[model samples]
Target: MPIYQAPVRDTLFVLNEVLGYERYTNLPGFSDASGDVLEAILAEGARLAENVILPTNRVGDMEGCVRHDDGSVTTPKGFKEAYRQYCEGGWMGLAAPVEHGGQGLPYAVHTAVAEYMVSANLALLMYPGLTQGAIAAILTHGTDEQKTAFVPKMVEGVWTGTMNLTEPHCGTDLGLLRTKAVPNGDGTYKISGQKIFISAGEHDMADNIVHLVLARIEGAPEGVKGISLFIVPKLKLDAAGNPGERNTLSCGSIEEKMGIHGNSTCVMNYDEAEGALLGEPNGGLRAMFTMMNEARLGVGLQGLSQSEVAYQNAVAYAKDRLQGRSLTGVKAPEKKADPIIVHPDIRRSLMTMRAFNEAGRAFTLWTALKSDVAHRSGDDSDRQAADDHMSLMTPIVKGVLTDKGFEHAVMAQQVFGGHGYIEEHGMSQFVRDARIAMIYEGANGIQALDLVGRKLGANGGRAVQAFFKEVGEFCEENRADEKMAPYTKALKKGLNDLQAATMWLMQNGMKNPDNAGAASTDFLHLFGLVALGYMWAQMAKTAQGKLADGANGSTSFYDNKLVTGRYFMERVMPETAAHLARLSSGAETMMALPAEAF
Candidate 1:
């Protein structure tokens, strides 16, 4: 059984002390999000996650989602009721607009709330997570009527949301997708296509499922230029504004996968389904990105949440398990053996997981805070800078977090040795579950390509440069802090390395386009590690200040933050050195291999 306590207190430290949620709350559209309100909301969410959602996870996994012969899908037992609890508690609409029945909280607070659920039950939480993004897209790009019709239900959790991007033949390459939406005379379009790997695609968790689909408009253009987004409801709407007639969209079947089986990953069939355009015709990819940005961040949280949960279990197990005498000689000779924590190797594995999980949390919260600035800042220039920074960081957040998150999970499992691999120990589930995050939401490799080939140069390289400038300011301001010296040094070194790599790539890629594709992955990870280290430093400074003021009491939390920050600086941050070195190696090193090299 995976027992997950919401790291509520720790989350508060990150939000209130580290990120200064107080100032963030003062941002436009978030005036009501005071520190008290944020804490109260997170506390309520923590209780629900611990008492309601967490308990259902093992049950959901063991039961999984059922694919009925009649073409319906059934989520594991207790999910529907739990989802109802989530909705009734206003969980789904944490960051949605107040007019749409949402609480209109700051995205940073919601990020903390979601951390609890995802850590407790990611498979189950995906139901509402996707819904939140769907609601965001419709609200941002949909016609006024679409918002009036769709936003309320999604916010109320009466209907769930699904993203329809991947097809049988396409994942990241939208240009290759063949799904089409033919305009009909009566205003509604006819969407005809098959979309695969749709999470929460077909489930009984809600009264309806709203799919924000991408398809080609007839004769619009070839490739991605022709792609457009549509709003396709599983249940056709009635005149009374209720779900009535059956829509042409149907689930052909659901997928059986290695993990996340609690939610149905389905093959959807849209046979001339009546659909409405989300935005201007032939402008769907741009519209779909409204949803993608949110989904990408949510997916990044999945990585952070799972790694945290896995770390908790591994630490508990390490402190309890008795093992052979430590190499330094056992202190527990009177007892049968020393607890595993006495062993240096076990400590290394457990500490590695902790280092990544803590840094990941800080990085994610910082990203969420940036998202808050991007959406709510009143100053146009400030908002644009925030958005640019966000655009630059999204792929790193999604790619590096998921990639490293899986590593932490596996490393945590290694703490349990054989027990981690065995099903009875409940450790393997974390590894199995975290695996898909890397492949989905645009595969990590693809995310790297997007970071290097596109976002880095968006608006003429200003976004990437502005990002470094902000980090430089943070480092310069805190360079003299007693506990922050190493952090400043590590962060500055990492930033300089990333900048050198960026400059070298631009100078080299001009002559060889192939160089960008070959080095993107390493470069992306290098950038991600540096960003995480920057965040870890921020966390350490905050924790140390709190301890100086006698705020943390006798707990090890503050000391642990300092240790983990140092560990990350020493171990994980060095990864960038290797990656940057590899970036200088020509693409031919990888491309030169024969097709049948094996």
Candidate 2:
């Protein structure tokens, strides 16, 4: 009734059938997670999403987190209970390694599960999502004592986590941060600074809150490199790893944002906070990157998930909302009026959202699988390759997904006509909720610059070339498929466009650094479109084979894939051309304005 189905079948297609994630179980550390185990995990995750979490979404938006004068925050009613159920269910550490008391499942499985959780409730999902990233960073770079003290607690969901990188004066520009970490006598540090736009900064859902703070050492270098990361807890740990004294960190205020009201975006003040160092001294920026990288992918998942939910509801509404007769005569003539879905344009928008949502899922899984491979594989080359792929795709995952993802949400809202503007219909909330994802986690513009200016040339372009080479492999294999001739050809064209765009950015940026900043956003989108097109083609090929097998009346399942693939090729894939043209036009327009220009 809520237009929210598990999408379980499609998730399985991506997990077991297409990506073959079960092979990870063979890895020494991932022994606990196999096909049957992951399947069960997904099943339970779906049950929780549909039953436990979906019920709270509307209420969460209506009654967001309440901030109090006592510096404590209370979540909306039922949020605490729902989070308890989630923690008790072990969903918090779905992909964490077993050594840390996590479930040790493949990230591929967790990604599919994440789609469900977010579609059910994006706001509530942010709590654990941010926590998971924080714990991951601590585990990777934190001292042994820190890990022993904090890892199990977070992995068990007793406490939560937040990333503190933004400030009122600086957000994406970390170089401007004035947060200070002065060395103390006890080998600890005293952190005093202001951090803004921190999600889950102050909440009542968990016992203790672990904040990974990015601040500068007093005499450190001026920009990003000068900063260091520290682990500041809401409740200071005692000798046995439990919340003891209150840490000096407190919320200065919470941000009033356009959307995601349930998520507390805090303006935190770390006033002489006794904080333990996470890694090496003056290595805060590097340590903070661990959290940022994880957060970036998570933000992308948020985008894709919003698109999926919006598309689902829009499709349901279109099929049910009746207005007028069809131009091609009415199939539902006896029903007083034809369903809105009968109109070509309405179907166009629905298919647009549906196709993009489906392919976006595949792309996300593909990206997550790369992360899994990087972590699981024993070979150094394979590990590095997977890491390289993950790094290269992170920007696309964040920038392109959120940008197009917002478009998909808006398009879905349009399908509802006037009703979408009204909040009771639950459509406007999707739009509002998804908009912030584009702004946070390095901002979509910053992601684009990182992709174009940094990752494109990282390792001397080996990463970029390796990815293009993989696309070439996919294209070569698909050229022989009868169903993929057109798809393959279109994919090839998009690939050429991407390669040319990449080369142009690389050559031009070497001449003028500012040019990279100007052209980054367009080039990122161009890269995303081309990459997604290839993903869809591969998905179509796989779906076609599965459909030909005629397993369990999956006709509609794979039939929709072919139809949606066609829609994307015709409508969506053509978007790269415009972006490519924009990239070629040069960055003069972006940098032309003088300072303080009206």
Candidate 3:
């Protein structure tokens, strides 16, 4: 069986040391997350993931979710019990507001714990993952009565939540949405439509399911402006605010998917379901984005989680499976052949995954910290700057992490050779599961387009410019430190390429829109390389500082960290040059071919 162990030590290193997680104690939730408290939470989360969650992964994949004739969906065995335990642990409300019955801890802490759980069993955790996103949306945009009626139970995990936006004909274009809503003559509206590919839409794990549905109100407008969001529960609440009557909605069927079968992706059919307006009419798109952004970040983490677990299993396999003799010498004469780990090629693959996973963790936490500051800070300027960071990094995080994440999973699978391809080893499941992250939560291609077309030029390029300044200043600040020169120099080169690409887009893309379209993905990746390179440089600096301070008896840990960071700088950061070159070449040859020619 494949195995997974949460990287607790590395996560703490990124949080406490590199990210300065304690420096923000002034924030509302940060004060509660003391070093000791943070460690305890992670330790407990790791135990749950390794012991309770990891065991269910393959079983969930093999058994999948089942849909009955009555439209009730049953998850794989042990899922209901695991979910109950997860809720009882108060994990669902770790970072939620205290007013809403959450522990009110820092979001960074929640994110760290979330990584462990996701790495253990992504399909299972997704049930609550979607709930968390719904909580965020309702908290941000819901009315006081709405919060009272819904947020508490949802946070307690007694109920779950889902976002319903896609229809049979429309996936990306909201203007094409046909779901309609008409006034019910009371305060509510009648929502009637079919939504497809809704994850966690119908399940027996929770007592109730709250759905945030997007539909066009009667005669609101012609396109997206006509859209409105609604709070539609699977079971309508009674006067006592408990589930009373079955709502006019049902799971039509579960979609046969390539992966994440444990998550019931349902085709939902609504017949005049009673729903309340979530926000102002004609403002549904704006309200729904709150949940969408959170989901996008979570989806990015999913990619990293898969890569981490796959890398762990691959490393274990490589160290035990004996193969060809080492080219250097016979180090293991007792065995018939040396372990495959002794081979340079195997080492290369392992090192690559290691390098990406560590830096990827840092990048994710860094962004999560930004989210904390944006939401918790009292000062307007501080909040704006933090929000700007989120706006700029979300796409890069979603696109780059997922794109590389899937590639690394494939590479780790390659280490197992034929054994990896077969189902017995479970590497194929990792590959299949990781595949969806790249396509969902705004496909990587769309993420790239958003980065290039909307985000870069927003606010007169304030976010991108601020990003460049931060990285450039970091490079300048560390130029004189000999130990930091390797990482800083490589990061500086990558940053320069990103800047050049940005400039090229500004100069040429405006004249020819197709040029921007062709360059979008490359530009987003180039941006991602620099962002991760920045992460590596910061981590390298932290590792050097700790080592100079004696590392508190962790010499090996700090030493290995430096080695991995250096590997990323040498092998991975240079790819930015290729992205820059390709993007600068423009869309001429690429777009010259006619569509019919193929």
RMSD of each: 1.5, 1.6, 0.7
* TM-score of candidate 1 relative to the true fold: 0.97
* lDDT of candidate 1 over 424-508, digit per residue (tens): 8777888988999998888889899999999988999998888788889999999888678878788889988999899989988
Per model, how many backbone clashes are there?
Answer: 2, 2, 0
Report the Cα lDDT for residue 369, model 3: 96
Model 3, span 460-513: residue lDDT tens: 999999999999999999999999999999999999899999999999999999
Give the top-scoring candidate (lDDT): 3
lDDT of each: 0.87, 0.86, 0.93
For residues 127-224, could you state the per-residue lDDT of candidate 2 as single tens digits? 99999999889988988889989988998999999999888888878899999999998888899988888899999988899999998888999998
Where in model 2 is the C-alpha error above 4 Å? 28-31, 550-552, 593-597
What's the ranking of the predictions by lDDT, best on top? 3, 1, 2
As a whole number from 0 to 100, the lDDT of residue 455 in candidate 2 is 91
Question: If scored against the real structure, what TM-score would every candidate get?
Answer: 0.97, 0.97, 0.99
Give the Å shift of residue 367 in candidate 2: 1.0
Better of 1 and 3 by TM-score: 3
Superposition error at 405 for model 3 (Å): 1.3
| Candidate 3, superposed: residue stretches over 4 Å from native | none
Q: Measured by TM-score, how close is model 3 to the native structure?
A: 0.99
